[model samples]
Target: MTADLGHGVPEPATTAATGGRPEGHLGAAGPAPQVVLNLARPWGEADPLDLAGAALGAGLDGVTLADSPRLFPDCLLETGRILANTGARLAGPCVLSLGLRHPATVAGALGTLAAHHPGRLLAVVGRGESSVRNEGLAVPSLRTHRESLDRLRELLDDRAPELRLLGAASGPRTIRATAARLGGVLVDVGADPAVLGKAVRLVRAERPEAEIWVFLRAVLTRTAAEADAAGRPVLGSCASRLVRAPDWYDLPAELLPRVEAVAAAHDYRRHGTPAARGGAGRSPETERLVRDRFLLTGDERRIAGQLAAVRGLGVDGVVLAGALTGVVERLNKLATAVRAGLAIDPAVRTGPAADPAAGPAVRHRPDRRGRNLSAESEE
Candidate 1:
């Protein structure tokens, strides 16, 4: 049973609380869709040991090791080992910067794991930000990123290991390209229902068979008030991330300034601010629009409603960003609520979570521009 993306496209409904069919295409009798749990940020100093414990306890399906090189060097291998040891689902760490430099290297690292793990890896990609830049690398444009991803797939040689590499894109062009080249697109930029609908429509127009997932900040609070309070930072954090780099998500150029403003105000170091990185402020109009469009704060039922709204728009799955508490506890709580509400079985694990090509399909065209670019991505 394919889920209707509220637009004309049909998606598969799932029993899992994370909700959705598999990341791959859903045939008439395809198996269940896997719910991907992304662990992009550190849950406030929560140790990896504790994080694993919480995930195992909550019954998550998978985990995505983040893009921070300093934070996730051997950490990826360690996390993979832990998840495998615990009998939990394991997705690739899939740090995006590596792909920016060497798509083959990214594939090799993950491909080696897929070969070993066999059926437990899901590869996710993202637009590297300050972290990527900090490493002396420039963020790849959507076009370049898509092309690189296609190259990585070519390098894979259809191994069909337990892995599926997904591209992170929200812009129309990227979405269309993703539908053209890769397995799916995970919209990690804007959580707005309208934006989601637009993305799905753009992708569906081309690859009607592509998968679309929404990554949202979620809190299953004790009450609506608590949920709202917890939700503020999640909203601000997203705004901060997007406002700084609107192009990453293919946001409308007009709305970019607005997002940047709100992000500036919501400093991670400041009290009541979401724990996000980047510089601060913008014009009043830009701030207001960013506040209204990107910030999503509310209760669980409300969050679920917001999620439903997004679902109605076009998302295949909701990678709920759990509350910002200590890592272990928060992951535990998130896994419980999201899994329960989405009807996910206790047995499933939530692993981490993202493109394309064109006419004549000129493959592996040496990127003259990127060749000179060091690993450090420009902002």
Candidate 2:
């Protein structure tokens, strides 16, 4: 699939490549970055399918399920259930740790999901954390990650899943491998513009046509204090990754110790939870610094500005890690921010903006069997 590099903004090629028409494809539709909801289960109290339905209803681009079986439900099973029920395209089970499942097993499960939801599923694999850490397994090296991805790709060759397999990469080596071998690279770092831009440039340099997706922690608050409060818990997840590899991010020297503190105190059992107070030791001043630097936060207007800045960096899409509480409400706010951000460019925000309370129009495509797979009926 060709990367949409027009206007210096990256756009998803899946719709064009798969012969499906999503709301905003390349060309006149404008480069509206695909907004994928990260439905990492067990974090939220609501049912996963219900969240998927609500997100799709809100007109978000797609949904990604976490692949941590011990902490969350089975990703493949939940994905099939979501596809069977909603029109939203699926992008996970992301970060499938090579240490837990063999390449063949992972490929078989992915093949089955794609076969059932052809043209609407994307597989993202990586050397995962939390999932493997909790089980006492070592996270695979970059070499293992690349080799596993290669083996999985070869395994699905004849089966014809007809889907793109993306690699979740952050470091230089893994990013280059993803560009050369996989369908694309999903940047695993939190939403830091500098880091994201560097990652995008590296992948684009290696393969100009490769798709780039970024994962960001999302929080909406009226004040900086509220932003810090809402963002502290989510930062735990980021700190966990950063602590393991300090050189991975371009962090300020003053904040390095805080990050290390969070990493040293991290508990796998509380991974991705609001209760995960890895940042407890951080000074209030330091916590605020981390929040301002790493998270996508602020009121609607501020968030709009931040997202517009992200779009300027040229990412194909952004996957938001949902807030711990009021998941649906936060998603609606995010959708609003995205719409508001697009409005920054009059040419990009076309048509009436979607109402946060009402369901947005979701387009559907036929599976191999020629059956319509949309949430709404066709005329």
Candidate 3:
């Protein structure tokens, strides 16, 4: 049963919330999509143990820490604390930039962690966006980036087969390249069912064996009022992340001007913050449109609908990232609100909240040079 989603994309209606693999794809029908938390900042700088407990209580499958070495505490150290404290089967650096550490050293560290915990370690690699840029270094070209991950994959496999390797891609070329080189892809494409479906198809087309995950800035609240109260950061995320992939999903014709303004004003340097202003017009209309497209806010019903829409697209999982404030609170809220609503069942016993690619995720962003970068990217 196929349903048209108005954007020339079709979704498999029967698959909604079933966690079933999409048909006609080459990848193994793995477990249902997982819900993992990739910490942008320590849930208001909360203790890692408390955060791990929050994840467990929320029925989360995994947890990942953002790996900006200088801006925050060591992600691996935080990961160790989470692993030691919680029963979570997935945890690690959401993205460890290749520029900061040699793949061999990283592989060694994660491999060691996997040896102690086993099947619980996962690694994501990117061009080292904020971290590298902070040091006044240039990000790696796609070729060098992929080659480095390829080596990381080789070393990881030799040390711990259970460990999974993923990449953060900024466009379709990177998505395709990531699908070919790594275990999975972390995408920031739009959360529309059609867009999710398209991303799934694109990754499987390149490497049916690969897994996929969506990176979203979400906070599922108990009330609309609560959501709106703390939604500024989420709205900010829309401007920053979505603006990067402006073409990933179609904006209403009425909102194009505001979106363009957002693109023009997007702050590439502070791209990860909830306060990042990617240039969206200040009008309530623009904020609403951007909010509805990129964020998961409001009450439980709204959160469920969005997660269902994402899983409906046959995605294997979602990575929830948000502001430093109330992150733990939101994760706990997701356990109750999202778990109850979506019936999220993470099959991962050890690794893979699992993914690492997409249709021009996929908002196929236009770089400074105006070349379309296709991805649900980070950075």
Candidate 4:
């Protein structure tokens, strides 16, 4: 049966109780932002079922399947299989490029998945990195991406209102589009505190209620070397993006040329591999800088401090990605650190809690940008 898409669903409110805190302040009263595991690294190296089970065992709130078919398995099928086998919510296919599939086709698929998963599914679409470059396709312009999302939302609202649509954004324009039109913005750049803080403020100014999510590479290790090695690919990816769109992020002035060099030199064929050569490969210092600036690394205490700092920025949630080697162990360590971080928040108080299994609900309303607005559901 088709679900009514026009009815206003009462999505959970972005109150201080849930992770969505008020602008400019961390809301300790709410549960920690949901920690999602990105299974991009394990897509081909590990079985999807095993990864899903590991994610559930690690107590991750959800799992995101990367949508690079050439580099990984089919995300849709893998996600469906995982959803069938485990209770871990599916967070995304995080479409790497646009124009490959018609928006309606993507919308229909997501709507069907939402119908099956209900509140457990979140649809994250964006101009992803490696997949497009590998295909020799041009990244869709910001305007085209926004329009695609707008069309996708319309289709989903007409067919399945319960399915929430979010855009992956890094710059001012995409952030504005997400605040104005989509359900939320998944900030997909390095976890630089300044960049994150600025993005959150930008979205809030446009739409105070829009959900804000940040993605970061996380590893729990005793030494900086181990952490840097584990996070290099992700860090390099961030540097590549910075180089391609220098104005998109607020990176330090001195680092721009180096970052641009990395982009210019990045070899897409060796994507996500440790040996993947890039201009950033010029020196160990560049690698270390990218790792420190882009990732959450070090021991539990240090990682906890970093997570807390991000939460303090009023972020709604965080998506953690890591290397394929010992992926489950890393996820377990990160989850433990997240719990510790949440425990330390001053705003957290002992009280009757909301359903722990329930995922964030999103609803849309008309906004000034002539786009649809999405917020945490009060349900």
The most accurate candidate by TM-score is: 4
Q: What TM value does model 2 have?
A: 0.80
Give the per-residue lDDT digits (tens) of candidate 1, residues 271-304. 2224442334435455435444554444345544
The TM-score ranking, best first, is 4, 2, 3, 1
lDDT of each: 0.49, 0.63, 0.60, 0.62
Better of 1 and 2 by lDDT: 2
What 10-residue stretch in candidate 1 is worst by lDDT?
Answer: 359-368
RMSD of each: 10.9, 11.6, 11.6, 9.1
The best-first sequence of candidates by lDDT reads: 2, 4, 3, 1
lDDT of 2 by residue, 1-379 (tens): 1111122222333555434425454311345566777776563455777777667666776688777777777777877777676666554676676668898998888888777767667677887767788687887776677678777767877575356567887666677776666646788766676676677767656665556677777667766666656664456666755655556676656667876676666566655556655545656665665566567776778778887656654455667776443445766777878656744331322111222343322222213222111221121
What would the per-residue lDDT of candidate 3 be over residues 196-243, giving only the tens digit for each residue? 555666676666546677776566656655555454544554554455
- Candidate 4 lDDT score at position 119: 58
Give per-residue CA lDDT, model 4, range 142-180, as digits (tens).
Answer: 667767877877787777764545678776777777677
What is the Å distance of residue 92 in model 1 from its true position? 2.2
| Model 2: residue 139 alpha-carbon error in angstroms | 1.3
Error of 4 at 30 (Å): 2.8
Clashes of each: 35, 0, 24, 10
Cα lDDT for residue 250, candidate 1:
60
Model 3, which residues run further than 4 Å from truth? 1-31, 42-44, 134-137, 221-245, 251-257, 263-275, 278-284, 322-327, 344-379
Segments in model 1 whose C-alpha atoms lie over 4 Å from true places: 1-33, 41-44, 72-75, 98-100, 221-237, 240-258, 263-292, 310-316, 322-328, 340-379
Off by over 4 Å in 4: 1-29, 244-248, 279-281, 324-327, 343-379
